[model samples]
Target chain A: MELFEEQGFEKTSAVQIAQRARVTTRTFFRYFPDKEEVLLADADADAVKETLVQHLLQKPDVTDTLQAVTRTLADFDWEKLGPRQILRQRDAMIASDPRLLERELIKQQQLTDALRDVLCRRGTAPDIAELAANTGSQVFRTAYRKWLEDNNDGDLTTITENVMSLLAAIMARGPVPATAARLP
Target chain B: MELFEEQGFEKTSAVQIAQRARVTTRTFFRYFPDKEEVLLADADADAVKETLVQHLLQKPDVTDTLQAVTRTLADFDWEKLGPRQILRQRDAMIASDPRLLERELIKQQQLTDALRDVLCRRGTAPDIAELAANTGSQVFRTAYRKWLEDNNDGDLTTITENVMSLLAAIMARGPVPATAARLP
Candidate 1:
């Protein structure tokens, strides 16, 4: 991370990262295929998604699949990934580079798909699972971004709840006239 | 679409597509830079986002940002791009190709950003605008995918409303215990 930040992501090499870590280049290849993967690695994404799914699966009630999904995500020890500053830098790097952003989005979609599948296995209706999973993830994403941006003040779960409330309020505002006419 | 399905996306060539359409290859390049763009073009994406933003701007009530966002998307004459069958084919091709899927996801993010910006300009609080825009786009995405799959029976607006109702129910069921304690 220090090297990537210093020399820029594009300029850094996998061998340099390995050497800095005191590992052989071959060892680095075993863990991550490329330097980009070192920063935006899929290595941990699967494990994280699985951990979240297992947490959601063990929840007392998932009838509120959205709550369960968002809570599971928000409640995770995200600090385990790294300090907020590092995560923010990682995100900024991904945002600035299209390839990294694409990979990040793919990782997000995979997480959403995993959440949807777990909800389905828990016996929520398929369509409901899909909607709740997608909506909850989106809500969490907004909260997560804000939590990262706010420096030190806000809590993730509270921000998530507030975002959920905003979503509810938005829905409560009733449909626009054009589509309302068509709704049964 | 037929050529892509028959020959496979990777195997098909832009020159073949242009020739089949009885247009010069230069004309094709002018319209779409490559074969992938021919399938998932950003050329139309910007225009569509601008159109949707304008539609939302014209609505009688922008306070219901979610409704306005989803309705603006669902109410668009999607057939203007192509018939449902051709659109579905395009989507399938994109889904099967990683490059195409990355382009599609990027396009989706751009649309979401545009919606958020439009809501902000309409006087919405920034956080609420972000959440509503993301949530609304997610809901519309669920509906759109289902609409594509459900052969002959569903209207996009109705499906979107159903998905929104599912979201409302999910939120109403209340938060799970762990996060509830964290919420005020």
Candidate 2:
């Protein structure tokens, strides 16, 4: 992350990265096939998804299920991660190529599908479950982006709560009057 | 869409599509550079974004501004689009390669950023705007997905309204109690 941030991802090579971390190029390759894997690693991604699913399943109420998922997400140890590590990694991925962004998005879609499946099993309508899953994941993502920007001080729970409130407010406003609206 | 569905995106050629549509190959090329553009032609995408921005600007209340954006999205002309047409495009894009999906996601991100900018301009904090934009888009997307699956029936406005309610319910529940007894 440091190397990518200071020197830019394109200019920095695996050899330099390995030397900076006091590791052999061979060791780096053994873990990550390419530079992109450093950011794309889903090692803990599955674990987090599993935790959310388990938490959601434990609550019978649909609302309670969402709350449980949010709570489990909030308890994640972002503080333990080295400062600037994630931001730098994000900068590198988004800067280096568009492909990384796509991979990240596909991963998000996968998570949504997994969550939707969980909701479906819990007896929610298929379409409603799909909507809930997508909305729930979006809440988590909104909170995560804020949490990322706050130098780790922001509580994920609070951010998630705020996102949910914002969604509710938007819903309460209902549809715009159709007669005056121009269809896009 | 028919050509792609009958065969596949990779197998279907521009010549074939042009022939099927009873249009000259010249006409096809004039509209789309490749076979992919048939699906990628987001003629209304920018217009929709612009309309949302304009609506947001017209509103004095920040909450009203966000709601206006959602309402604008719900008014999309999904009815005019053939269900098979959309499904074929989606299947082809998902099956062919990751690049197509990435491009779509980038487009979505652009929309989210635009929504965030509108909120920020309306006096909401930058972080809060970012959160609102993300959540707002999520609600829009969830409702749209449901609308699409149901053959685009049931007023989109109603679905959007329901999605917003769901978001609120999720948010109102908030995080699970930290000191509560653990789930069985």
Candidate 3:
């Protein structure tokens, strides 16, 4: 991460990273399949997903799957992942490189799919489950970004609730009366 | 796409694809930087994004940005992209390959960012723009998947409307009354 931040992700090599860490290239490869994974690696992503899914599954009432999904995520101890500054740098690094960005997105999509499946298993309608899972992820993403950007460690739950309310507000405004006529 | 479907994406080579197309590898590279692009390429995605942004800009009312974003997408002549079966097959192919799936997601995120930027340019609050763009995109994605699966080529507009209403319903249901107690 230090090398990537200093010289850019594309220019940095796995061998160089290995050298910096005083390890064999083979050992580095064992830990990360590629240089992109070096920064994006979350050995615990699957575990985190499972923990969140289990949390959602245990909810006494998941009739409101959007709220259920959002709370499941927003309520997690994100600080346990790392300090806010480190996570922010990692995010910026991913954002700066399209390859890393794509990998990050696939990881996100996988998490969303897992949440949707959990919702389906909990008896939510498939369509509603899909919308709730995807929308909730988006809401949390916005809140997470805001939390990272805050100089003071922001309360993620409050940020998440505010983001959710923003979504609700936009949907509540409803469509313009004339837009229907504009459809082809 | 035919080659990929027949032999799988990873198993196929650019040389083989070029051979099948009766073109030199040079010619193939001239058109697509890689085999992944062969199936995932949207030569017109940028143009489409620009067109959608322009439509949103021209909206008589931009206050309802979510509706504006979704309607712009739902109203487009998606049929012009290709037949339903071809599009479905392409979608399936992308889904089966993590590499292609990641690329597709990046493309989707880029479109969402473009829409969000347009909304911001139109004076919507930044947070609201992010939520509306991302949420609206999610709604349309579910609707689109449904549209592709329908044998009769279901109406995109109606499907998009239904999906949007599902989101509205979930949000309107409000959070589960007791979930707050569960939050740490």
TM-score winner: 3
Q: DockQ for the candidate 3 complex?
A: 0.34
Model 3: lDDT of residue A60: 94
Question: In candidate 2, what are the lDDT values of residues B14-117, reduced to their tens digit?
Answer: 99877865668986676556878674445445666676677666665665645656765676565444454464445344434444455567668778888788
True contacts kept of 3: 0.54
| TM-scores for the candidates | 0.77, 0.64, 0.78
lDDT of 3 by residue, B109-159 (tens): 999999899899989988888888998998899889989888875799998
**In candidate 1, how many Å is residue A126 off?**
0.7
Segments of candidate 3 deviating more than 4 angstroms: A1-40, A175-184, B1-40, B175-184
The fraction of correct interface contacts reproduced by each prediction comes to 0.46, 0.32, 0.54
DockQ of each: 0.31, 0.21, 0.34
Q: Worst ten-residue run, lDDT, model 2 chain A?
A: A175-184
What is the TM-score of candidate 3?
0.78
